[model samples]
Target: MRSLILVTASCSLLAACGNPAEEADDPIVAETPVAPTNAVDGMAGTYEVVMADGTVVSQTLRADGTYSDVAEGEVVETGSWRADGSRLCYDPEGDEPEQCFAGGQIAADGSFQTRDDQGNVVSTVRRIGDENMTTEPTA
Candidate 1:
């Protein structure tokens, strides 16, 4: 009789084993987003930022991945830009932590939006017109 009770209890425990297929997909699996390559190239040009009061700041960016910001007849920011796989990096002339890569936007209209490493938009630069740059001897 004890063996019978033990067998009956084991059978009851097995019968209460709950349902399968509680989940459909693997919880451990996740998807990651891919970044674009030439987000900055679309912004390569001389942009003039017009403020609310109509103030302007001009910036010239080269295709070689170098940029210069001119304000008050002086260059404030000078840096080289490059792409690391899917990331765009902006490093100063040398080893400096001021490099911006976290959040940057190059609009289709040649406007630019710079952001910090945390992806916060810092500055907005708009394309005014073609630089029409020419080199000649200064008479």
Candidate 2:
């Protein structure tokens, strides 16, 4: 009886150890990492800015902190930009003071609006492309 019990236990252990399908079915998968959330990450791209006066201009926000505004195929303005939470601030190339705008939550259609202090819409910005500025390598 003891020999019979030992043989049954040994067969059970071997059967469990030899089953490759059970191990394959329950794989040890590594967890995928989550990306950090930042407002500037979404803002780095080309956009079409429509002012409240119905004037339209093309703006490009580079990932390297520089930006340019093009109007009528001419570079009208060049600036450096930064974001503080949801607020976006721009410092133009000249002696002009820094201009900061609030409300930068981009919409599903790649559109967002900048608002003034009194909750007025300053401009409507729509993303036109996904091309971001990249710096060239130095030798």
What is every candidate's alpha-carbon RMSD to the true fold? Answer: 26.0, 25.0
Q: Which tens-of-lDDT digit does each residue in 1-139 have in candidate 1?
A: 1111111112112112211222124343223323235544333455554332344445555567665555556565567555443334555555564343322334444344444346544445454433344111223
TM-score of model 1 (CA atoms): 0.45
Tell me the lDDT of model 1 at 136.
Answer: 16
Candidate 2, residue 60: how far the Cα is off, in Å: 0.3
lDDT for each residue of candidate 2 in 1-139, tens digit (9 for 90 to 100): 1111111112211221223443455555223333336545545666667776766666667667777676667676777777654456677788877666664454545455666546666676665654454222223
- In model 2, what is the error at residue 46, expressed in angstroms? 0.2
Q: What is the TM-score of each candidate against the true structure?
A: 0.45, 0.64
